[model samples]
Target chain A: MLKGETETELEYANMHYFFNDNTIITAGKFLLPFGQFGANLHPSWINKAVSNPGIYGGHGGNGSLGGVTSIMNDTGINVANTWVLGDAGRIFTDFYAVSGPRQEEGDHGGGVEIESKKGDNNDSMAFGGRIAYAFLPEWEIGMSYYSGAYSDDGDLNYSAYNIDFNWVGSYSSVRGEIFGSTAETEGEEEGEEEGHGEEWVKDFDKSGWYIQGTWQARQLGKSWLNPVEFVVRYSDIESDFDGSIEHDFEEDGGKTGSRIYYGVNYWLEPSAVLKLGAESTSIDNEEASHTSVPDDRIFLQLAFGF
Target chain B: MKSIKFVFTIIVLTTSAFSIKAQHVNDPSLVAKGAKVYSENCARCHNARPAEEYSKKEWSVVIPHMRAKAHMTGKEALAVEAFLASTLTADVRHAEEYTKPNAPKKSGAELVAQFGCQGCHQIKGEGGKLGPNLDGVVANKGEAFLLKKLIDPKFNNAASAMPKYPMNKDDVKAIIGFLKE
Candidate 1:
């Protein structure tokens, strides 16, 4: 069972059957294999930081704060396979088709609505796939692409493309990812002709990128405290729309900004961590009237993977 | 409602089946081989977690998931499961033993070697060339100063890459004793 701020839901209820050593088929509501961040690192325990990167929060929506970038669970079928490359390399590929996101009636007033990307109903089908290659024990690279219908009328559509890579050495590790997305919106002409009051279409072009590096102290010396890790990360998200649109991207606290995060993590165990970190956010449109200054935040989080 | 029930039923049965198949192995040679596999493959990405961290059931679920991510073959995965099951279920010290007073006491040189201090600090003409030479430095600095540096290297030097060792009092004293010698 998965519980969120607004809803308590079952995140993934999937059935998988293995065909052989290298192939498997799955059916049910599953996490979409969209990108490395969403598929692997979005979990609170697995993610290095307290908060997710701004871009994984998904794009354009009602004044409400739900988007599809992270935890995009959908009802569908997925086929996955792995192939060994030489002695120390492997290639993995996943293909899936699932019900896409939808805009549901929001609890807030003023005709505001929230986006429901989870598998509520198969209003429209979206198809996508991901391919990843581990060239060495310490290195991996992946590419992801997803496209689906997002509107009840099937007029609005969405598409996303991403590239992510990770490399881990004896003492330090580096990870980076960049993604861009496009979604159709109600044009100004449609809003005017319908006479139904609605917000104008914000820019549909959205892109985000982040790079993180972590250094483990235990590798350098012998101390019970040597398991401490120093981490530094920088992330940025840009939208085609100016600050005119009132809707907030759920993850970024409603503003497009560049963020620098530095933190220290004490590994109680490999799967458990005590983290202290600070994030500095610089809003892109400081002069805009509707834009609010995003304050730098300090956080301490205890995360453990069971 | 019916679909939910069906899904729930399938999950219960599948989990039960997996649990039935999971068992611990007592073979020493196999356990040793599993340990080597874990150190070589699992330690490549992150620190190898202590086996005592999870129960057999927990490892039953966690190992398969990680096996998929780490691209472990069937045989390798099974060996890792056997290793984790045997180790975690057996009497063992937790990974953070240095924090406990009951931790096994080691000589200062053994602690230094265990922590790979020689990789960066030189005792005589040996060890890595990154940090300052430690030869005779302990005599120059008193035991208090040495203890402070051991507990938190960054207390005096913020830029120091030296990690905090969170050692028990006895372990710190032992290391200090070795340095004095």
Candidate 2:
């Protein structure tokens, strides 16, 4: 799931049914079961950085470091289940089918948006699933894959995969995810003016990853300092599509560069947190058009869950 | 703006409280289990949401959404529901000062139950198996170790899923005393 795409209005509404302890079926609009950040850690109380990985932007954004990936919520039906493997291990799975990507139109035209929020432009539906394994009770690793038609003509297609892992120790935690994707698109030289203009077909590829670490300030001694946490994350995304319509791909977080984020968070209580963070981003593609260059930033925020 | 927000919070909490009392449950063990699950699972993503933030109906919608997204077991979802319900039925206001300074003295057993230690630590052959058995842990680990662990569960292991409780000397001593018995 992506952050910038979230609307202040109803984010999503879905109903789920449990067939058993290990199986559940959900219908209607819901969050995309993509990577750890979109599916899990996007919530303010949980995410360590004030800003998400630039590569995870969905749409409506042209962050200098943005790259087209995917959205956070869409109209879909998903089934999830868990299997306890003996006493020490477990397997978890989530599968879904939904309105896939749509060809971008209007201001930034020629590319794909990666989510059919207005509903699927084509009759074809998208499909995806994630499988994960848990061991040592506190450690987990997962793999996810998604594929579907993204064009109104249903001839153009997009596919992506993500690998993620998480581990929790008494005083620290580590988690991260890697996402890679490719898409086929056609734009007339003039992007397609009937039979009058030559056709250009591009096989665009993009990929990115982020790793985060957090350490609890337990050894710091003061009981009042016990709730403090130090966190750091690194992220990068790259793309091969150098189309003239750079904004179209950048809307989906397709800009190529790397970012480093470091922060500290203090828990006012179990349900409230105060955060101080700083981020530095480096851009690689000088040809990409952006209103402003990707810049380093510092921020402070208070997030209360109640 | 602050006044409006506070009023909104109050109205939501008050309405949810009414619904919770109608179906109030007093099962400490279930609440304990819910407490443990809520922290261990939910904390990984963000701060724990206060139970009164949602009505039972809202939680009905939220829990299932999370259950599917997080791949949580049905049992855990139910445990969290029970925990939230128990909290909503509580008379205490969320904005009220927490853990009052002049709180009445509680028995070590009460402290143990309040902290939900048995939810993870095996206690007299009962409770969970995630943490080490606490049946005779006082004698085995020594009082000093237990005291440190209580204040900072990560004192011994950085990755311990065990939560910390910053208790004053009296409460820590009482917890250790109860473990010895």
Candidate 3:
């Protein structure tokens, strides 16, 4: 070991009763020269079946909370050690309706801004894990799998599963994820066909896979007076599904997105840096074929390490 | 038309009054405020000296920390900010000095200065009782965690009696750099 010194660190933060219906708790610990790893847990206080419209894909009633636990290692292995491995796992109850929100959709905590929706909460559970290893200092490859459940407003049931391979490198990282699902709808009542109450409908199971990648680069110390650095990156994902959920949900064969970022890091002193960047991403989903909504973002950051 | 004008005047006056009231109070001159608060409230249980005479970043971390531990109010805390800002070095105003072909090597005093390692504990190879001795600290606590401990002690040990230091980012980095060297 090229011994200078090494140490371990652990940190935790918790916030309860956020937005009147949710609680969040997180914990992290790292071993020196190794990197850091942590876990995040969210528990809901309301019933998912009949909660808010946007709470859990309608069909909301009482629901259980779920969470994601991850372990990441930065491997101080350096050029000599060369190879590193990262592993993580996530487990949840009623995950289809809850976990999907945090991963596939936009953030709910838009600060002071609030959006409202309605529907009964769905019930489901999901669990999965991933393991990846770096063969070269600039590249890594790995795989992951997850499975969960989905429940209708009535006592109907549905299940979902996902598997994927990941490749990571110094300038870019890519992942290919395959997903599938099965569902059974409740039948409508005899007199209320329009309401579709108690009506049981079955859709062919659906499955598909998509691939995404992100790339980055940086430049530093261009001039003594100006002394600035630059960084840029891009990413995308696409998948296909066999069925649709009427006006609420649809199975698009796939979707594609492209993003661009440009930034500068200005060093004011040996210990401080001021960063500014502009970013934009465009996406075309299979279901929303005509609408092109590309997102643009801008930001400024001032950081000091001393 | 006359009634509308009258109401508009009233609204303008009310709005101005509220804005004036909402303005934060600058109760004291900026200099010495952070130190004053530290000596008056925090110094009793914790040592008042800067950790190895930490940089602006170190102070930034330590200062905000006094809030949760000492229960200092928002207004009272602003005064502390002014004091520390004045003492610490300015922003990355001199980037070239760092990236230069031959930057000066760190002197012993400068090393001690940044780490403020002697502030709470002893070095050479022994110093204070307020915290553990550093001779053993460097062995297990690499430069990173040590710097983290200086700025945010509670993160390392929730039960630690050590309070956070409110130094800004640069000062923390400066201290961290020195320790690493």
Candidate 4:
């Protein structure tokens, strides 16, 4: 359980039973393995930068418009396995069924609400899978797909796809992910009165991507400075929707912005890090004439994991 | 009194056996298997770190955490632990040695001799004939050039056959000082 200033939450509660060396079955709420960033870098100590990239943070109001969000967890069951291929490297796969996300009332601090909790809201079950191949010791590529109903009435549906890659070298590392999603909104016809009307469905598209790189100071032959690392990241998100759709979308239509982050991480130890960085965000709102001004900010964080 | 003594002996023997089992592995086949498992499983997400990078105690914590992320079975995790325990001995015995307040500082000439520079290059007319004489190389090439060569000879001379030394900044400075003298 995680305790915060305003709320107490259970981050992950699960049970796993390993059937053998190659297979394991898990039941409970687990962090969704939708992409590399959500699974591998969500932990404060593991992430190199002080703040998450715009795409992965699930902030900036972009994900609400059918874009990919950094889903926290899903109440479900998962089966995962790893297969070794000798010289060709290995492959890891996860197959899961879960209760998918439900849209919240309004935006909270620019963050979208697409994470499902313990209680079930929809009768339909969502199913998806993630497949990753480590072609080499230092390189890996993964692909993920998830689809399900988005509304209690089941008129609205969404499907998301993600492709991610990670490469590590002796002195440098690079990670990147790109995702695209589509949501269909079924609207009632204007002519019909009261609660009865013809249903009209419209599809919206959302997509985002980010690439980050980190260089270790030891590459300069300064082993004493091995704890210091330089990091840089660039990210962008775009959400396109039909203005006629009867949804409370942002005034700017949806979050359409790009961000660049420059930072350095100092490791107090292998498990702890102090991060300092600056972030600049640029919004390309189609209705920029009336949209709020964009601002740049500095980031500072101290994170550790025991 | 006799029963108490027998129970104490049993406890002492069992504790010793458990302690020995936990400390290190002596089986060569298990160690080899562990080495292979460590290399294959740990290298998937990140670079494989050398065992000497962390203390045995540190590994005790790191291994279990990574086991969950990598989805390793209990037996596989144990094998990997055994491999690291058998091979990755700590480089420093004690933390104090790293920050020894009164540790004797070696002189420039002593640093040169420690690195065996005299084996290839001559300083003040005493050394080998494999490389150019360093008697005036410092004056002719400049301190910056000499420093670079010392760190990496091939950077200047592509065909150079000199081996690179893993010297820190202070060691490089001391070697330069000895060459100037």
Identify the candidate with maximal DockQ.
2
Colliding residue pairs in candidate 4: none
Clash pairs (backbone) in predicted model 1: A222-B115, A223-B165, A224-B165, A225-B165, A225-B166
lDDT of 4 by residue, A38-104 (tens): 7667667777777677776433222212225556577776778777777537688988877775644
Interface RMSD of 1: 8.1
Residue lDDT tens for model 1, A32-143 = 7777776666656567777666565423111111223443567767778778877558788988877665544444211112233333433566778889888654678889
Where in model 2 is the C-alpha error above 4 Å?
A: A1-9, A58-63, A187-200, A242-254, A290-294, B1-39, B48-65, B80-115, B120-174
Greater TM-score among 1 and 3 belongs to 1
Interface RMSD of 2: 10.2
Scored by lDDT, the top model is 2
- Taking chain A of model 3 alone, its TM-score versus the true chain A equals 0.39
Candidate 1 C-alpha error for residue A217, in Å? 1.3
TM-score of chain A of each: 0.82, 0.88, 0.39, 0.88
For all predictions, the C-alpha RMSD in Å is 9.1, 9.1, 20.1, 12.7
Alpha carbon lDDT at A270, candidate 1:
58
* Residue B112's lDDT in candidate 3: 49
Summing lDDT over every window of 10 consecutive residues in candidate 3 chain B, give the lowest-scoring window.
B19-28
lDDT of 2 by residue, A88-194 (tens): 47788889887788887788775767553566687877889889887633688999988988887899888999998988754678999888888876665653545
Candidate 2 chain B, run of 10 with poorest lDDT: B89-98
Give the range where candidate 4 chain B is weakest over 10 consecutive residues by summed lDDT: B89-98
- Candidate 3 at residue A137, lDDT? 18
> Candidate 1 — which residues are off by over 4 angstroms?
A1-9, A57-68, A104-118, A188-203, A222-224, A242-254, A286-289, B1-47, B69-71, B86-181
TM-score of chain A of 1: 0.82
Distance from true location, Cα of A204 in model 3, Å: 11
CAPRI level of candidate 3: incorrect
